[model samples]
Target: RATKSLSLTATSPINIALVKYWGKVHEQLIIPANSSLSITIDQADLCSKTKVELIPTAEGAEPQLRLVLNGKEDKITSRIRSIIELMRERTQGVRAHDDQGHTLTLDASELRTHSLIITSENNFATASGLASSSSGLSCLAFVLSQLYGVSESFPDEYTKFARLGSGSACRSLYGGFVQWHRGFQAIQELTEDSAKVSDQSLARAVELSQESMEWWYNNLSILICVVNPGDAQTYQKDVPSTDGMKITLETSELMKLRLEADLAQKHIDQLTGYLEERDFPKFAELTMKESNQLHAVCLDTYPPIFYMNETSRQIIKTATKLNGQGNIVAYSIDAGFHVFLFTLKENQVKVHEAMSVLPGIDQIIITRIGREGVKLI
Candidate 1:
């Protein structure tokens, strides 16, 4: 008998959503109310490097997985193991080989020991509140999927699975203003017979075509106000982000307004049209207002959750007031404290210079439209 191993490496960027994905409807599935948009960043300087190996081992042993942060051997939990187990089930008969070049079977239950070494590093310092966890989790799920032999043919499902680990992660799966469509729950309200018929019709009517959706290509820049810089920490101390959102949905009336905002619909339509027309000033105006509206709801939360600070607020004001010419720049933030400044490449240097003078801030991380969600190495 021989042993074989598969080593795969992938990198993903931390994204800042223009329209935030703060709340969730389904905790386990991580379904959001509305579609959120984002642009991926460069992976060279900041990313997660993961290596998954499968080995044939003796019986009656506890299956193991390991995570290494920097050079230290950190611990792994059952939740992490469950993620691998789920992948194993979905990828049965998919095998890796050891350095000896012999095939090694990957059975989650049969394995007594395993090594899933994950090493993540960031260009900026840790605790900066830059949504780095979103990128890291997305990359982790992505690399594991490849090493475990899950087919890449279904990009949507693959992205949805990645979202289970981090909501913003689904956006990281696509490049250049990717939208996560949280389709209306009209299906949930259907009668059983009607639901079956509707499902069948949807399956048939879904056309896989690209000709109609190709107008979105253009040059857009996603600039990060990278504050505080070390590695991003997992939100394990609080309720799972998904569960926190569920609790919010139940108690927060603002969440209700967010779900049913008529003006918001109008704003989205007008902004989308403005985007298409390249109306820089109007687009930037709408983007700033919409982001403030989203944050208002966060303020309405009981006990309140503040995702911004004096510096973030001042940056918004400075950018809005200082616009004297060309392409207008827009700003948006997510659950974390960092700001995502968007503009055309021509206006980037100006925006960069303007933001450089703001107080209590660090450097600006510049990223353009990314290539794709996950790439294999």
Candidate 2:
């Protein structure tokens, strides 16, 4: 008998980049111009949970794709459609056990006749510069993979699908210190084909020594301070990230320097060393510098995009002040106004106290770094 339907649930943790991914080499393929490193935030504080149901359609009938987020129907974006189509094409005669332990064979032709219903929800605000898309898209990709019986044909194969949905989503597929490589040293080094380049542009977890992992788990504390709460609509960006990156790549002179110097790779290497040595001071310094440079590059753009507000500046000042006495905290901001303060567990209380007094702060969440990525539920 033909399988009636397949369903799976997945949860993914968001990641905050220390070595940020600011630009793209291939926009359609979502390949980055530079490598990035990030720590996966624990799901206890922030995450996206997604469930996918694939119901087979009648012969010759076009399958429908639907997405519901936070209990509201969301338009399935072109980026998302691309992921679904690609996954369907890639699904050959794959076999896997469903959630009920029933053996299922997923064929490409058979998958093409299935309609997908995806329902996702985030514990935190979406599009609020909190990496909600990363967790959301990654969770979707993971659940789809299970339903389609898609296995990793190559290293980080599943991440490739997630990357198509959102550039940062690739990094969210792994836990701990994850690095998303830019794929090639130079675009000229490879053929003009984007397909081959995308295969190389994937994310992997940076292997840390057991001792270092233990230290990180024991001491590291991530404090997320949401500047704007309530509705996600209020926090939408003036310029979408894709458009902002295009402007920076075209007009920002500093972008040329950033690419030529390969600053992202350098920061990744330095940060990795600092993490291994458990050098909090060097780690904090590098983290803050990278964050500053990212925003500076944005300012250098033609239209000059400003993601940080007065409240954001106040948080930076507080982190700096606290660091002056001792390197107790390092703050990193994405293309949004909220601040992620990285500090030791011993100083977490101090950092929280300082952040609480800051005006415009909505709420504070205290969580540790996560050691796992996307998981089936």
Candidate 3:
């Protein structure tokens, strides 16, 4: 008998959602309430690197599985465990895309019979909002699937398993402009039983080819200013983001008008056109309007959670002043204190310089929208 070991590693980049994913539809399945659009950031700036290994285990001994994050061993979350189990069951070869579909046979594959070890690490700084988690899980799924040859066999299921860990994680599986379709019922129709799943879903993802990568990569820039360089876990607030969204969904009048798939599609249509034509003014307009709309929804929340602080407000005012003078610079803030300045590459220098001196801004992170996604190594 011969001892055997197999190993592989992969890296994936973080992303910023232009069209935000706010609420949840199926909490148990991690489905989003609405569709979302995003672009990945450069892996060099921020990413998650994961390595998975399978080694022959002693006969009759129970196989072991372990995961390490940032060099520290930690217990695996149930979501990740679900992904592992799904991968194990897939060894018998895939059937149709139906969730109720079954494997052909219960074959003890190489992966199932061996002890496994998975290690992942994020390249982040103090100002990081821990945005790398999505990329981390995405990288883990990518590498393991690559080893199992899932990208060619069952690409949709590969992405679907990533979403099991985090809703946004599915989007990081692709590059360029990406969309995550909402609702599970609608998603089933998007995939063909025997064909490739080209479109995206809450359980899967699709990457859209906007302008060529070269065009956007050279023309667009995002200047991220960390107004509050604090860990999201350590930061305290009146209402947690998830709780705040739930309150808004139930009580806010604005939520009644805005939380619909039709609205998302309308915005997606116009934004997609603007992106292809490089219409900075229209692009900036949508960016600013959608951002403010999100904040308005926050304000309309029952208890009114304030993710944007005084400094955040000041940056908005400053950007308004710049845009007043015929500049296309726009800003967006997530449910956090950091502000993102979206501007043309030509004006990036001026936009970055003007925002750097704002009071309470601790650090400036210069980054362009990345043109690629996860890669197996």
Best by lDDT: 2
Among all windows of ten consecutive residues in candidate 1, which has the lowest summed lDDT? 199-208
Of the two candidates 1 and 3, the one with more favorable lDDT, higher being better, is 3
Indicate whether candidate 2 or candidate 3 has the larger TM-score.
Answer: 2
Please provide, for model 2 over 103-192, each residue's C-alpha lDDT reduced to its tens digit, 9 standing for 90 to 100. Answer: 777677767667889999998877566888899998887778766667565337888888888899888887788999889877455444
lDDT of 1 at 267: 62
Give the alpha carbon lDDT tens digit for every residue of 176-292 in model 1: 455555544432432323322222211001111233223223456668886532233432213344555655666678777777663444565676566556566786777777788
After superposition, the stretches of candidate 2 with alpha carbons farther than 4 Å from their true spots are 1-3, 58-62, 93-106, 187-194, 229-233
lDDT-based ranking: 2, 3, 1
Q: Candidate 3 — worst ten consecutive residues by lDDT sum? A: 97-106
How much does each candidate deviate from the true structure in C-alpha RMSD?
5.2, 2.3, 6.5
Model 1 TM-score, 2 decimals: 0.79
Regions of candidate 1 where Cα sits further than 4 Å from its true position: 56-62, 75-79, 96-115, 122-126, 186-218, 228-244, 262-272, 324-327
